[model samples]
Target: MAFTLPFFSAKTLLTTTTTITQFPENPKTLILEQCKTIKDLNQIHAHVIKTGLLVNPTIAENLLESSAILLPGSMDYALAIFRSIDEPNPAAYNILIRGFTLKQSPREAVLLFKEMRENSVEPDKYTFPCILKACSRLQALKEGEEIHAQIVKFGFGTHGFVENTLIHMYANCGKVEVARRVFDDMSKRGVITWNSMFAGYTKSGNWDEVVKLFHKMQESGVVFDEVTMICVLTACGRLGDLELGEWINEYIDMNGLKGNLNLITSLVDMYAKCGRLDTARRLFDEMPRRDVVAWSAMISGCSQSGQCREALALFHEMQKVKVDPNEITMVSVLSACAVLGALETGKWVHFFIKKKKMKLTVTLGTALMDFYAKCGSIENSLEVFEQMPLKNVLSWTVLIQGLASNGEGRKALEFFSLMRGKNIEPNDVTFIGVLSACSHTGLVDDGRNFFVSMTIEFGIEPRIEHYGCMVDILGRAGMIEEAYQFIKNMPIKPNAIIWRTLLASCRVHKNIEIAEESLQHLVRLEPTHSGDYILLSNTYASLGRWEDALRVRSQMKEKGIKKTPGCSLIELDGVIHEFFAEDNSHPHLKEIYNATENMMKRIKSAGYVPNTAEARLDAEEDDKEASVSHHSEKLAIAFGLIRTSPGITIRISKNLRVCTDCHTATKMISKVFNREIVVRDRNRFHHFKEGSCSCNDFW
Candidate 1:
């Protein structure tokens, strides 16, 4: 089977059976020409064999290369032809090497290179570049380095193609420093070299270095292209540097390189991330073409900027345009639903995910879990947790927090135990949830133990949120003095939230002395926040010190502070109904008022008494009673009672902590109607059932 004839001689190779005028005179040239199909190649192959050209190396190599590259499913035939050559050259070995690499079989190329070296077929410049490409694809750093040494030994290191390939190999292998060293050693740098290095830095998240390298390239007067612009915009997005990003945009305009899809996408992302949504959207709308990435950037930007409703609306619009949402789009959409507490929309999204057969990755699964938890769907949250095949620290923490938020503190603690049994180490957020569970359940001792274990056992230093939770635990349990003392003895400086926690607790427990102390610190820390002043003023009013209450009110008026009006949300028939204090502007305004009056009468007869102390101090008794009766949450609840079907649980979300009168009214309504009511206020969830609350009337 071995042939050792001259490589490409035309003298003794002709033995044609057909007419000689039909094909090229040179057999080598004819083999290199394009064939329409495998059938055409087989005919030409038959011609070559009839011409006695099987002994010529060039004809054989060309046939093998054409079959390996152009003809699909013919690499086996190419390999057979390659094996038949008695002493194959490097060019022959390179044909199969490149074929395997192109077919995504990098290991095969490495193996063939080994065979070629053993056969003493010295590699040329072409041989080095092809094999190095295979090494880059495989990320075989050791093999690539071996090739590098051989390149130097063969004196082919000076070749531009070889040098560029080397740079790419090191960069792709994550040895950016080594790649940089190679770049520094190169005497002739081109666009490819700079792009390779910039891409490496970008992959490693070294955006500063990318900017610095780009500056150096500019100073060196090297020509910049679209790829360079993309890398620069990415750096701007990461750094939130709007100034430089704009400058780059100007440069693009000046250079007349507009309408580049990738460059436009980068600019959109950069402006959006830099907190310039208007500019980003303007640029996005002006783009001649838009893709999924452009739409996702806008949606994600809206979600991050606290425009969750806008984000969801845009997602709907994106679908109408027939652009399918990717996983990231769904994640952002789910987050918007969580913020809006739009359970129905979230369910639709979940169904869409299933309908599209989208795989629930850990991140997407975690986002869904968070959405359900915040939307008051603990069952769904737990279901996602259990169904997820993989769990990270965030997954475990979200589930724990969800349980705590739903007033299932005991269950949250038990889940934390299970998490530990699985050897999943708790992070700071995990312990925050653990301590919060104890706080909600009034397990003071458990809270203390977990707080200590956070630092001693897990080495997670107590963050301000953790300390605030501990203060809330003690303060809510009528230990206001202890909470104040705890703040004074803190290792780090206590924040305004800690003092605010103590002040709010003081208001509930009527600890006027410690309330004053906490308010002093709170006012100094946050002078403009109206909540602390309102809390202290309420403390004064609760003690019947009208003058002191008036004094606090005067100070607030002088400082131009106003209390945040309470707002409540109730979902009815998949639509959220919002109500503010004394709000009577609903479309069914008369019916809502009539329902509130009827519910008030029924609850009053059922042993519910109006707690008028929450009303304004300057108001008369009648006015106080009227204000307490028409509070935002009561209005929302009355609307729910009128709109929802019988025996349905009512869920409401509040902007501020529920007032005492509204809390009592909801508990009575829950008992009289034999319905369970769940209210998620600013602080914690209150589950009212049968004249009882999950918080044990503590929050």
Candidate 2:
């Protein structure tokens, strides 16, 4: 029911008319219209109450607008005055509806519109625009369609404002094609209409369509704005088209467009994502102001491009500069920590997150879980996983991968069962992790069953990675003949990595015939890869075929193929130190060498026999021992022991697989020095403690 008030009468309203005539115009109206502050509006409200001027609908509308639209968070005051009116008009309803929409409470606006309609308050052109905006914000496509029918019923189909909103509603609801049809039927087009479609395409990840429409907008000579450029820059970034991004940057500068923080951040992100870190950093430094997003873009780009250490340093710089990090920033920083296996630093980040009271969102939780898993802390990874309020496929996959890589294959499989019980469908990555767990645990039958079920039950078509995992499972189980037949019968042509996996297994089991076959396929598939030739050489060397080993090396030299030297990274005091095989480039070279010598002597005394046969060096025992002692992992571990306190865990990241000799030596060192060592090699993680490894020496 409409609320009534006896505050206004014919005689009292005459006082407002007399007052307005005496002022030669509507000065009270001007005060209500032009008042900038709530305090000024409050004084005008007092004047309205004293003069009983709200009975004049024009005066009341202005007052309601000033309260609801001009002053934010004053909706209560406007609604109080609106309800006090005996019969609020359409203008007053429109004012409140627009206020609710702008305040991001669109549902409230929809409710108010419903109330207005039920009360028989006829809507104006302004009313439809306001409510349509609410529909777009709410993504209420069904209700928006009903409103469209009403617009046609009212013969307002040709109205530009209403039609423009209809286009926006469809676009935001992921109905881009319907939006396009509406746009095509329009007799007149506005710049906002074009921008709406561009934004829609971007939301749909249709970058190619975005670029096409951008050109179309340009051809139509419709002046575009910063919003258009922002969407275009996003497309350029995702496409990794550095040339196009640079051209857009030039366009911005040439047009003298005002550089807002959003635009600048987009440019920085585009350059960073395109692998132009230097350009990104320069733009980042030159920006007059920086926000968390600008910092996150650069950090994430650095992490994704394998500059993990650099990304961590930038994250520290962000902290020192007092730019608060959001969830995205934390995700990027955690990714860097995972890459470097800097568990100490990752722990500090976790502490900071808790201290800051940041919400443990799924993305951040997954990152923390991944960091612990990669850092050889699977227990902690499981804790993070269980504590996460929400778990997506990514979260579950990380935990499974972490457990599988840490040699907890049975546990990973059990967790997969639990996930299935919860009805959480697994994706391709999850299957890869499950297959890897099967391979690690020697569950051949289970692997085969899962592979078949992946298609028959889950409808997940096996990709190349899944096939590779299956081959690895069979190969690692010592079924060389079966693995070979599996590769031969593969529906998809096995790539070089798949062939290399088979060859490595052949080397492990000393299957000469299969090794030669796998090498033949690998050589043809990747003729220029020095590693491929080196693998063949190693296979021959394992079988004591010196002549064949020499032939493989000779072919490599003839083709100018230089093997990638093994390098290892050890993080000490939050700084990463790198060492190459036999490279004495450190300032403490003499001390590091002496430490390695002492470590080797002690380990030998503890019955550690050096496996010098696998050494590529075809020299005397002493020469081979000397060469193997200075390998990258040994140097890094020696340096770590010499510099760090005793009993401290040493973490190392190796560029290539840890050699058999180095692996054995590291196991002995872990026992001798009473230190736990975690090494992340090219393939998986190895945690050595007390003369044992987490992989049980299978890796």
Candidate 3:
């Protein structure tokens, strides 16, 4: 094989190839072929400079055409070559203008057009559309009108591309009326022109016009694009029209349009907000791939529907799939924690925030503080507040509320003062927190000053909540008549809470007449709540009005309104034990009952007398004693004593306010059992020790 072939000499091969030419005769075609990419254009420019043909007139014109049309941003190199010519033709200016417009440099395009006009370069039909596109992107309405005049001057106004871009310019610049006028005046229109008008209406949020235009396009037999479908779906979402949204979904499915994540996410959110969570979940499940947005929508829907546990479960499941959580996800999860009082879980979220280095924006920080506060971690709530990089009104309000609810009223009031000192002007909610603190701590004078300052200093008009706090403060301080007078003079009508506060104070002071007046107003506002009727009955019983008490109970029965049974729960060793009135459900019920009986004996011997009158039973003395013995807090304490050793604090949370008989019994039990008992009811906390309550029998 090596000896089979003969090789030609280099001199003979060069002489043979000298007769052939490799390039085109027209340099224009050669230039166009050479200017394929930016690097190729540069190489051609170098070759042109080396050939000494750069100054040649015909070659320069051809170079301008090749560079401008072949490469984007080649206009600059082409313009340099064109300007080097002493007298460039109109075609050169047209090439530069079109290239500038194509590069989205609209301002420069307009400037080039001006330079061309000053140089007396006549524009052709192609020149008008390019310049009009530049005007549209720049939103240069006045300049666009000038271009329109030029178009009419050039007799190209009726041209399709020219007229379409004019419409786009006017519409995009918020001159839709002008756009419509142009469209109406047009002798002929294309699908691009109609689409421009439709998109203009959509951008203006004119949904009705968008729909009308869409129908008009359909009547004209114009085809729609994916952009149109997405836009209509957005409008439907804004209207919360489930019917329309479903129609659009069905249309998309029937058309077999490839479903994208954005469309699916929007549909899910719209359905969820319209109270169609099941449908939302169905749509979400049908998605081929679940993004973070899809997961967040489902989690938020669950939270909004009061399914906090389910929302939390979904959040954990999201983590298992390694879908990174964003601000929206964290906010929804934190809200779920707030509703569930999930302290440990909320803390873990906080830790995650730190590990991820997420910015604690005002809203996110407020949500975190709210979660901690609601979960009964006021200290952690305060820490979150202090560490916040930015503080809004809500941040300050949540911290103050947390402190007030945790019985740190003094600290709450102090923060309110600090807020004022910092000139963080107080709003109505700020006053609510401060007034609530005053109510909790019995600072009547401070509350009155803040209430007055609300209108006088801050110009914040007082609402019903503010009035309620004022009434509560006075009522809790044993000024029942004063609270009644305040309610009478309130500018806004007193609500159930205002009247209820008065009735509660009346019960405490044994004032039957005031209780009757408050009860009358309460029943008129909220007649369905059984607690209101029960409170009124208890007030009557405390006043020895057995007939009125019996009448109230009978009316409740006739209305099919049953009083909520009082139940208390205690947490011990990470387990919660619940007890109800007269409950014997525990396995060691016998032992618990015996232990409670013995404790009661010791309590009575220590001077604790049962106040059955507060029960409003209207029974014989023996029956009243039995009724007092079967209270839920007594049962909880009995179970606590049987289950735990002495000297440990017993914490119980009751659904309803503790009755006077149970309150007295708890104080005595604390002393007899040598334990500190903490009872949290709907209103506030009661700390009992050594046969006395921390409230000094005032609460």
Off by over 4 Å in 2: 1-94, 101-187, 257-264, 285-293, 421-423, 541-554, 616-621
Give the per-residue lDDT of model 1 (tens digit) for 1-699: 222222232443322233344555555554554453555467667756777776777788888878888678777778877887788888889888999888888898999999999888899999988998899999999999999999999999888789888988888888889988888988899898899889888887888999999989999999988888898898998888888899999987887767787788888888887888888889888988788888888888888878777888889899999999999899999998887677888899999998998888899999999998988889999998888889988999999998898889999999999999999999999998998898888889999999999989999999999999999999988888788889889998999989999988888899999889888887888888877877887788888987787788779888888778888887676576788887867788788888999999999999998867677545677698888888888888888888788888888888888877788899999989888888888887788999889877767
Model 2 agreement with the true structure over 73-96: per-residue lDDT tens digits: 888888887887889988889999
Cα lDDT listed for each candidate: 0.85, 0.84, 0.78
Candidate 1 residue 355 C-alpha distance from true site, Å: 0.8
Q: Which of 1 and 3 is the better model by lDDT?
A: 1
Per-residue lDDT value at 283 in model 2: 88
TM-score of every candidate relative to the true structure: 0.78, 0.85, 0.61
Worst 10 residues of 1 by lDDT: 1-10
The sequence of per-residue lDDT tens digits that candidate 3 reaches over residues 1-699 is: 111111222233112122223323356754665445655455555655666777776777778877676666677787777777787776677777777777777898899888878888788888888888888889898989998999999898888888887878888889988888988797666677787777777777777776667667778786777666666655665566677778767877787753777778767876775668888889888989989988988888778777777788889899998999988889899998776555567788899999999999998899999887766667889999999999988889988987887677899999988887888877899889999899889999999999999999889999999999999899989898899899989988888988988888888788888988887898899888887887788878777888898898889889888767788776555345667877768776888789888888888898888777554334466677766787888888888787788787676767788887888889889888899877777776677888888665655
- Per-candidate clashes, comma-separated: 1, 0, 0
Candidate 3 to truth, TM? 0.61
* Candidate 1 residue 641 C-alpha distance from true site, Å: 3.1
